[model samples]
Target: MPASDPVTSRPPLPAAIIAGTVALIESAGPLEDQSELVRAHGAQATRSAQFMERAWLLGERLGLPDDLSRWRSTIHLVVAALAVLVALSALGMSRAVVGESRSINAIAALVTLLGLHFLTLGLWLLSVLWPGAMSGLSLGRLALWLGARMPGERSPHALTVVRATNRLLQERRLLPWAFGLISHTIWALAFVLILAVLAFGFSFHSYQLSWETTILSSEFFQRFVQIAGWLPSLIGFPVPDPVAVQHAGAQGLTALTGADVQRDWAWWLMGCVFTYGLLPRVGFALLSYLRWSAGVANMGQPDSGDPYVRGIFARLEALDPPLVTDEERRSTHPAHTLPPRGPGIPGTLAVIGFELPPELPWPLQSLPVGIEGTTVLELRLAGAAAERQNAIQALGQIRPWTLLLVCHGASSPDRGTARFLRETSHRVEKSRILLVEAEESNRLSNSASGLRRWSDWLKAEKLDAIELVAFPEVGQENA
Candidate 1:
């Protein structure tokens, strides 16, 4: 997509850039310009309209960020997990005296781990952790040392600050949800592995109560009680215990029944793996379902449910109708992700690195079109660590007269976000660099946030003589 240029646009001039700075403030609503306190505004902006004043006050009281749009999904995910935890605890009614406390502790430990992950996100956002540390956890400690030892370049950290931060493949902004999902999945899988090892490690599982009764007078044979406690958390089986379950093996109350030890153990393995394995993912699925429902309910109405949600729900239902064997169960890519959708932006251009579904509107589909002497290229910098690095290297190679970097369409403020444009700006010294900070990516990635930072970096690098211009919506029009 090409357009006629209004001027001899090799690279915009500093005077023109400085003149259009106000448009940044206008497009962004209000610019607090708090580099010191860079926080990603989350769901705060999406509070129910009826409670706007009180909600704003509460957000301020809690010192939370102003954009609460994500609160619905985040809260729904947590609440969904809590609901499952509650249900499982209620069903795993322990006859043992200390059973309740022990189970509660187990749940608490899991919850505490999740909470720590959340705190990690907040701390990273607050810049308490050294730069680029949290998201690039895959880097481990050595990366931290490298980042720290590397001298800080124009980024606020004292040159010494580089001594502590790490070299993340991508920026911290990319790491949060991606690594979060990875960590959570790893933990869930680890839990399943632990349960499998424990269950199989035991030798004589046929041990029954020998026709005895518990303090609650529950006549649960060992088999029944074991299944009872394990079933809900494992597969949502409403029945309490596995005692009544039969297949083939040892006999008598204390001895194995018709259930063969190996065969029964295999079932236990599959069941445990399925329950612990699938629950977190399923819970996330449910959380999305709930959030969508909540969104629809709040936003007037929906003609019907999303087919994606219904498909997942259908998959869940299929589990019981037709027995899926172990091999099929263990296979990866068990379910499909929802179709692509992007955040909203108006009167702005957006181009995702990847093929962002052809359904997107015009300017958004093909952006950076009007630059006079430069070709706008989009890079889908996804995948392994090496891939991201390669994308950056390729970016450095472009040698354009202007380079525009935008992602996700989220015009939100974030940390060290300016570094992207700063580095790109330097690479294309002959070209001007504009960081696209639209509503979707409007937060910290704001071009305005980096403008001063870039100027400062330029001065620090003794490159203050370079001409840089910012093209706001108005500026773009005038140009």
Candidate 2:
């Protein structure tokens, strides 16, 4: 089969990327290696969107499927089922304790089922005010885990899928937003179902709902009921009068009666659930979804200053070299000009020695007989740790001009040379890998192999060109 176009070639679809990421996780590979690929590819984009698209393409090429609708549908079904189960449990518990009673305690029921929802809302609010307080809630991880374990033939790959999904989420930085959206949505669904159950129960069975307190007077209870039921009353739900309130709170079996006021109490309870419990949960769920959507959008493009984006741009420039224009600029200080070269002197070019061979005379005190006019700006060592640092610092101070980096033509190109070239390339106008011609035929290897090594290294470093420089005669010393 033909390979897909590279990710950098065209824009990728968001859904494709989302599905692709899941596919990437499910692909056969160690999670570490898979994650490393993501880190490398993901770092190429400045925006989350761009990163996601490219990552999706990479993932697809790595065997991730292009379609993820099945997984998405399955997860939604599972989440809904989970919400329903929670609602059923709460309904069963609420009924076990309160259904048998002639009258239900409205305060107790509200606090039991919906109190946690309110607490979570408070915490969410706090997270906004003081960032990182609730950072541990990784909803994306939960969703990915749930998706991985969703029942089917796919269940066999659950653990690996989970690991891959996690690594992808971490690479994309989408955990918190995903977590909030999923969890809040689940809570919203649960609360809605719980209220539905309450509504169904009330429609079929008659239960007296009231607040009774032995320590509190009928007046206090009446005022509280009136206040609490005020909002519900606006939408045509019945609110009990002072007389009914007193009757309901009279605190003995004698005070309880099967009256029409029971209808009022039930409506008021449902109204409270709508106003206090369901509405707030829905609102929170919606808000979280909005934030998650915004986060998804942000994944496409990131701030310009992000280091990962910059690094990718650097690599991209190497792959498709951009036209470099020396734009006009005004500076207070005079620009540095190259020293003039006579016929005997080489042209005005900087010669940087990279692991200069000991046999070759140091600094080429004069340009080789044939190569005149080039000045030896510096002699830098490339291999050893200490020398590498010194070379980098020395190179940093050199003027921006044509740089001819002198390398041992016999020795093959290595990482040290690559690193030196990569680091110095940024500061210079132009750079060329100059392989030094051997003094004797005893050179460790032929120039062909050395050139081939440099070619491969330059390609890896995304460098465009290489050059060769021959050694002068035996006694051509600087004089």
- Overall local distance difference test of candidate 2: 0.56
TM-score for predicted model 1 compared with the true structure: 0.25
In angstroms, the error of model 1 at 173 is 14
Q: Tell me the tens digit of each residue's lDDT in model 2 across 1-479.
A: 11233333344334334434544453544222222233333344333333344455444433344234445566678677766776677667557435756557765675676677677767766655554566566344455567766666553234543454455444565555466666676666666776777787778776765565668777887787788788878877787788877766664223556556676777777787677777776776677778666655544343357554454445433432234455464444433221221121224456777786667655644443344344536665646767765654554464435566777776767656666665555445566655565474322234566767767666644454544444443544343
TM-score of each: 0.25, 0.50
Q: Which residues of candidate 2, in runs, are more than 4 Å off?
A: 1-57, 61-81, 128-131, 137-177, 214-220, 251-258, 321-479
- The alpha-carbon deviation from the true structure for residue 154 of candidate 2, after best TM-score superposition, in angstroms, is 9.6
lDDT of 1 by residue, 220-315 (tens): 334543653466444443322344333121132325434354334434433543554446544544443454344323321111264432432343
